[model samples]
Every structure is written in C-alpha cells, then in structure tokens.
Target chain A: MGDSNVTRRSGKNQLLDLYLTFAKIGATTIGGGYAMLPVLQDEIVTKRGWATESEIMDYYAIGQCTPGIIAVNTSTFIGYRKAGILGGVLATLGFVTPSIIIITIIAFFLQNFAEYPVVQHAFNGIRACVCVLILDAVLKLGKKALTDYRCVLIFVAVLAAALFTPLSPVLFVILAGVAGVILMPRKKPEKTGDEKASDAGGKEGTS
Target chain B: MILLRLFWEFFKTGLFAVGGGLATLPFLYDMSARTGWFTTEEIADLLAVSESTPGAIGINMSTYAGVHTFGVIGGIIATLGLICPSIIVIIIISNVLKKFQDSKLVQKIFYGLRPASLGLIGAAGLGVAKIALLKTDVFQESGVLAQLFDWKCIILAVCIFFVYRKLKHSPIFYILAAAAVGIIFKL
Candidate 1:
C-alpha cells in the first residue's frame, strides 16, 4: 500500500512537471505544432531524456493518426509516458490552452480588426510567413523520409495525386499505407549498430 | 433539430480529421456540398479567416461554421466536439503506450504511416496553392492583365522565399514583413 501510494504521488508530481514543460513549449514556439519539434526534442530528449528520439518520432507518427493538434498529441504521449491518464489530460490542456486563450481574445476584436490597414497588412505578411514555415517543414521531413527510391516514389505519386486529382486526403493517406505495405523490402534490412545509433540521434534532434 | 445535426456533423468531422487542420478541408467541402451549410466561396472566405487567425485551422473553421449555423453556443459545441476525440484518445493511448513502446509491429505501422503523413501535408500544400495561385473568374473577367495572374501574391511568395533563404529567420518575422509590404503596396 505504501509503495503504491508513493508511486501515485510521484506520478502526480511528474504530471505537474510535464504540464509546466508543455506550457513552456506552447508559450515559446512561434509557428505552433511543427515548429515545436526542435524545442520538444531538446527538452524531452537531450535535456530531460524522457524518451529516445525514435520514441518521439513514433509519437509524432501516431499523433498524425489521431485528432487535434500534433503538439497536443505529442504532449499527451510524453505526459502519459511519464505519468498516466491524468498527465495526458494536463499536458494536452497546457499545450492547447495558449492558442485557445489567444484565439478567444482575438475573436473578440478580429471581426472589426481586419478592416484596419495595419491588421490587414500584418495578416497578409503572416500568411506568407506561414507558407515559408510549412515549406521548411516539408523540406526537413523530406530529407529524412526520402532517403530511398521507394520513399521518393511514394512522395512524388502522392504529391501528383493530391495536386491533380480531386481525391480525398483520407483516401490518399490510405493508398500510401497500402503502397508502403506492398512495396517495403521483404527483408527488413538489419540496421548496423552505427546506423541504429544515427537513426536514434536523428530522432533525438527532432524529438 | 437542424442545429443539433450541424453540431453532430462537425463533431464527426473533428473526430475523423487526422494529420492536422488542413485535413478538415476535404470534409468541409463535402459538408458544404451535402448540407448547403455554406458555399464554396464561403469556404474560401473561411479558409482566409482561419489562416489569418491564431488557432488550429480545423478548430477555427469549426467555430466559424458553428457560429454561422447557430450562434455562440453552436460554436462552443462544435469546438468541444472536435476536441473531444483527441481528449479521449490521448487518455487511452497514454495508459497503454508503455506496454507497446518497443513492439516491432508498432514500428512497422509507423514506418508505413510516415509516407502517408507526408502525402497529407503535401495535399494541404496543393490546396493552399489552388487558392493562392490559381486566379478564377474574379480576376480573369476584370481585365487582360488581371487574367494573366495576381502577380502581387506571386511576387510576395517569391520575395518571401528569397528572404527565407537569406535570413533563415523565424516565420513570425517574415509574416510581419510581408504584411508590411502588402499594406505599402495595397495588395
């Protein structure tokens, strides 16, 4: 009983720490979820050693499958790992609370605010910046994902389908999964010790 | 009855929209077509507003659509419904993650998922391009030069691209800078 109690107490403390950590991530990261990657990697992997880089990448992949923001998914995964269900909730809340609060405040003033020249100009500029950020993310992810011909083929085919056809994004994702399943080399190439370490290291940088 | 239905539809949208907020666009397009909740033009406007705002694009659009459909309560309901799935999933996943942490199957599944995720992001880029680059009747019918293209957005895109390459600065800086240029040029 005493052991369980201590574990529970420690879990709660860990949850609190995760919440604070996510709050800091939320407050500092300028471009939201994708931009949060480097900072999250630093805090969760290098600084704290909460999860290895590969684990963080796994969380990111799973986050893509689930709803809400990627940042929220990541925070939930990390917090859950550290604590439990309550930790997941607290971490997600901490991550999203900043945007929610900021948006709510903006909502009050934005209707009329857009009419203002400065606000209009600012938004116009912001849109361009967002495009740049997204492009940067694409480039970064592409570098890691497109290491081989099969991956490149998937990227190009999917991009073409998305750009030309009126196919649903969900359908496209499903198709890619199907293709990956079919095309992935039969022998899962054994990773050398160095390769494994590098993979982990690459993940660590992004975690 | 209609309001409740609207809430449920948006709720489902929130539930299924994987990847990110942009993933909601295809669903929203279907919603507009099926229910006549809004028009394609309205969707464009919604996209513009959502892009400008400070929240997840999915949440922002949900709130906007809900408010348009009913009122503030509708907006709240839609937003709640969209986020509800994430809350539930996170709770469940958090509990079980450790047991599955090192599983090869999990790794394989994610390996497959990476390409799909990239595809989704790419699709989002295309969607944005369609809106930003392709000039429709609005620009075309106006005049010969207008029909050629909206050079302003194009120029802005190129200029920003170069600036991004040169400065390697955070997006906020570029956003602010582009907005300054837009206002100066009246674009």
Candidate 2:
C-alpha cells in the first residue's frame, strides 16, 4: 500500500509532463491523424521511449477502430501507460487544448477567413501534401501490417469500400473484427501431450 | 438545455464515427437533419476549417459545430461529449483488457483489423488525392477530358512526392512550401 501510494504521488508529476508534451504535439501537428504519426514517433519513441515504432503503429490501428480522434485516442493510450487514468485525462485534454482554443477563436472572429483567396490557395496546396503524408503512413504501416495475402485481401476490400461507397468506418471495422474471428486460426500448442512442457510453455511461449 | 443537447449529439458522434476525423462527416449530416444546428454546406465549410487546423478534424469540427449552436461553453461541452467515449473505452481496454493483448482471440481480432485499418487509411488518402488531383465535379458537369484535371496541383503533387521520397522534413515545412506554391500559382 505504501509503494502504491508512492507511485501515485510521483505519477502526478509525470502526468504534467505528458500534458505538456501532448500539448506541443497537438499545437504543432496539422493535416490530421496521419500527419500526427511522424510527430508521434518522434515524441513517443525517440524522445520519451514510451513506445516502440511498431507499437505506435499498433496503437494507431487500434485507435482507428476505436471511437474518437485517433490522435487523441493515441495520446490517451500513451499517457495511460505512463500514469494511469488521470494521465489519460491530462494527455487528452492537453492534446485538444490548442484545437479548442483555435477553433473557438476562429468560430467567433474569423469565420470569413475561408473566403479569402490566399487561404483558399494555401489550402489547395496543403491538401496535396496531406495526401502525400498519409501515403507515407500507408507505406510505413504496410511494412508492419501487410505480412500475408489475407492481410492484403482485407486491405484491398476495405480500400475499395472507402473510395467507392460511403460506408461507415465503424461498420467496416466491426465486420473486419468478425472476419478476423472467422478467418484467423488458433496456433495450437505443440506440447499438448506433455503436461510439464505445456505448463512451461503456457507461462512463456509466444510467437 | 442547449448544452445538454450539444453534449448528447456529439457524444453519439464521437462514440460511433470510427476510423478518424473525416469519418464523422456522415454523423454530422445526420445531426443536421435531427437538430437543424447547421446545414450540410456549413458542415463542408467546417470540414475545410477542421482539416486546415492544427489538430484532429473530429475535435475541431465538434468544437466548431458546438460554438455555432451555443457559445464557447457549448464548444467545450460538445467536445467533452465527443471525447468522453474514447476516454472511457481506452481506459477500460488499458486497465482490464491488457491481459487480452496476448490472447489468441485478441490476436485474431488484430489480424483482421490491420487490413481494414489499411483500407481506411488508403481510402482517406485516395479521397485527398482526388480532391488535389482531379476535378471530378467539373468533369461531371462538362463531360470532357480536357476540363477534367487540376494540372497545377497535380504537377506539384508529383514533384513533392519525389522530393518526399528522397528527403524527410517536419509536416509544417511541407505545408508551408505547399502554401508558397499555392500563392505563387494564385490557386
């Protein structure tokens, strides 16, 4: 109980650190979630050692299927790993602080900025690079996620739906989860007959 | 009363708009129908603003929409609503289902999810590409190949693609460079 209390006390400081770090990321990143990935890799993997690059990709995948902004969800997950529930709240709040302020300010004062030609031209250019950045994410994720034909098939089918049909991504994700359950097979324990070996393997064996 | 309605509306939006920011568009459309808070055209405008802003489009849109209907406080409440589900869901997964991470069932779910995730990302990318590369509506209206492309953005995209292949920079650098190109071309 004393140890748990000590951990919680120090966790408050780390929670603040998480808030500031995510605040910077939230303020700086543009063009949305995929654009945030490279920044996240820099902050989470290289800077903080909070997660691995592959781990970031994994969080992103889970974040996508989960509700809410993938970027904020990812921030919450990272913060939770570091400091528990309060950390998650701080991280999410930090990540969104700049956005809420910016949008609210814009909503009240600068709603007409979109009509400006300079802004229009700027957005037109920005949109293309956003696409490029997103493609970069696809490439990086492809290296990690696309290990087999089954993976490829799922990707292709989902891509077609995204481009052609206005399908809810939630529906597609649910369907994918179901597909996963049906298509993926269990890796049978090899030492099923030997109880002692099975015991050892059950404790530690992994792919 | 307005705040409660705003919170409930965005709460539902955040709970179900899976995939990411753009995924919320359909839900927002449904919202327009039910509450008459904003029109489809306004939502489109909000999307542009959300996309260009330095955060998740999902949060930005909800905040903007909230502000439109109520005020700054409404913006806060609505954003809270949208993000509440993510916090709840993620906290549950982290605290309880952490064990399931290693299980076969979880592994299988991920296997299926990875590909679908890719598809969603790819489609989002394709949507951006279409907006940047093609003049689909113009082509639809004119039915002519000659009037069917935004050649300037296309050339710029191709060049940027190659440069991005050889080098990497912060996202801001590319956004600024693209903005410069836009200004130069008076796009």
Candidate 3:
C-alpha cells in the first residue's frame, strides 16, 4: 500500500506539501473557477507532476458539473489522487484557509465602517459594477448553455418559473435535470443522432 | 441553535448552487428574503467584495455572510458547511465512480442543469439591477417617474457594459474605476 517510492518526499511531507501548495493557489487566485486553471496547470501538472494535463481537464469537467465551488472540487480531486482521503481533506482546508482569514479581517472592518458616507458611496458604485458583472456572467453562460432551441426553451421556462413563482430554485434545478435526462434520450433515436453525438462530444466529452 | 441554522442554510447553498461562484447569488438572494440577515443591497456589496478578494468568490461570499451574521466563529462554521459537501462528494466519486464524468446520466443532468442555472443567475442579475440601477425608494417617496431611475448609475452601467464589450478588462479595474466615479461625481 505504500507507494511513496515514486516521489522523493516522505508520506507525511507529501501530504503537508499538498496542503501548502493548494493554500498558495487559494491565496493567490484572484478570480473564480476557470481563472484557477492556469495556476493548477503550472503548479500541479507541471511543477509537481501530481496530475497530467488531460487528467486535470477531466477533473475540471466533472468539477464544473458537480455541486459546490469548482476551485475547491478540483483541489479535492487532485489531492485525492495524490494521497488519499486525508490528502483531499487537507488540500480543501488549505484552499479555504486564506479565504476565511482574509474575508474575516475585511468583514470586520466592513461591518464597522459600513455606515460612513464615503464607504456608502464606494459601495454604491461597486454595486452598479457588480450588476454589470452578473449580466456578463449570464451572457457568457448563455452562449454555452443555450446551445439549441430546446435548451433556450428550457432557459426561458426556468427563468419565468423562477421569477414568477415562489417555488424554490432547487426544485427548478432538479426538474430541469430530470427533463434533460428524459428529453435527451428521445433525440437519440431520431435523424439527429449524429448531431447529438457531436454536441455531446463537444460539450460533455471534451469539457 | 442559530449556528446550526447557519450551517444548514449554507450547506444547502453549497449543495444546490451548481454552476459556479455567481450561481450562488440566487440562493443568497433567497436567503436574504427568508432570513432578513442581510438586505438585497448588501448582496451587491458582497459580490463586489467577493470579486475583489483573492480566493474563490463562493468561499469569500460565505465567509463574508457568516462574519456579518455571527463574527469569526460563524464565518468558520459557514465555510466548513460549504466545503463539507465538496469533500464528501469528491471523495466518493474518486473512490467509487472513477468514470462518473463520462456517464450518460451525468451528462444529461448537466445538460439540463446548466440552462436552469443560467436562468437562476439571470433572474438574480435582474434582482440586483433593481437595487443598483433603480432608485425605488426615492420613486416611492417622490411619486415621480423620473425619480424611479438613478440616471448616473444607469449611465455608468451602460458605459461599463459597452467598454467591457470592447476592452475586456479585469473586474477589479472596473470596480475601482466605478468606485472613483462614485466618489468624484458623488453618484
């Protein structure tokens, strides 16, 4: 069961190294999920050799599809591959350490000074910018998600339902997933099978 | 007791906020409506804070929300609650379902989930737009149609959007510039 011979470091050191490396990645990455990819490629794939490029891509695809934060999920997958459960746990802990530390400090100051007029003005501007950011995110995601008429229909339906009803967003997600599973299979038997294959190849296979 | 509720609330958020960091916005909006722990305007601030910070926006947001509610300990609990699902789910997939990503079932679910996630995000975006771009409280008070709109913010948002379409700068730069505009123009 002892496979530490492949790496120069001892088992304990390897786990610690995994933690510290992810901590650095977490501490430095200023953006969101995809932004961390290049850093992961450099640190984990190239520098550490913990995972191959293709393997990293695979983790990212699965990570994006699954629940929770994409960055944290990718770290867990890589850490699990490198060491085991403990390694995965440590890597996740390391990745979140900087966030908790940094945000806690900032949150403290923000709470205390939020009443100041200068701070309020700054937040007012920042809030406007934040709206633009969200709209941009929606635009980017729409390009990927609304690939076809049916997908667009789903998007519209979901939007209407979510906005009009008091039903939980979670219900819509689950229902849409169920719709996908049921609806996608029907397209397979039609002449559109080739198109389905290509779409799947592009979206699911490579992503 | 409140700590448990916070953990449970965020745990649900982490589990269902499926697409990415901003996908969590819908859930956060729901939480604000339900709990009254933070206002809708505060969520826009949280987004700005999360975006400017050096970490996953999702983690930064949960930490900020937690700290707002119950201080450092609450931040810890909320963060732990958020990551708990990731650790367990990732470990399970790695151990048992090595080929999970390639499965047809998983692909189909993602196919449906993505668009729905987009809808949620778009809806959340509109919610924020109401707070940031519209002066609803002023409109209510003044009973004037002109007072319904914050022309400065609307102009700023339009300018920022067009500039972003052409230039494609980092979000931090836009945020900093917007803040400067707010300060100088008192927007």
lDDT of the candidates, in the order given: 0.65, 0.79, 0.77
What's the ranking of the predictions by TM-score, best on top? Answer: 2, 1, 3
Interface RMSD of each: 4.1, 3.1, 5.8
What's the distance in Å from true for residue A126, model 3? 1.9
Superposed by TM-score, candidate 2 places the C-alpha of residue B26 at a distance from the truth, in angstroms, of 5.4
True-structure lDDT of candidate 3: 0.77
Most accurate candidate by lDDT: 2
**Model 1: which residue pairs collide?**
A40-A207, A41-A207, A121-B179, A125-B175, A125-B178, A125-B179
Backbone-clash count (model 1): 6
Each prediction's TM-score versus the true structure: 0.69, 0.82, 0.62
Off by over 4 Å in 2: A1-13, A28-35, A185-207, B1-5, B16-19, B22-41
RMSD to the true structure for each prediction, in A, is 5.8, 6.0, 7.6
Expressed as tens digits, the lDDT of each residue in B1-187 for candidate 2 is: 9899899999998888787888789999999999999999999899888877788889899999999999899899999999999998888877655877657676667678877877777777777788877899999999999778888888888888888767866555776798899888976
What digit string (tens of lDDT, one per residue) describes model 1 on residues A1-207? 356698877766777788877776665444335545545655677777887654665576567667765666777788767766677778766765555554455555565444677766655545544555556556666776665787778778877876788765556665666776576665653342236448867665664
Candidate 2 local lDDT, A1-207, one digit each (tens): 256688766666688889988988888667677677756755766557776554565567778778888987888898888788888899999999999999999999998867788877888887777787777768766765676677788888888887788777777887888887787645552222133234423432331
- Candidate 2 local lDDT, residue A117: 88
Query: What CAPRI grade goes to candidate 1?
Result: acceptable
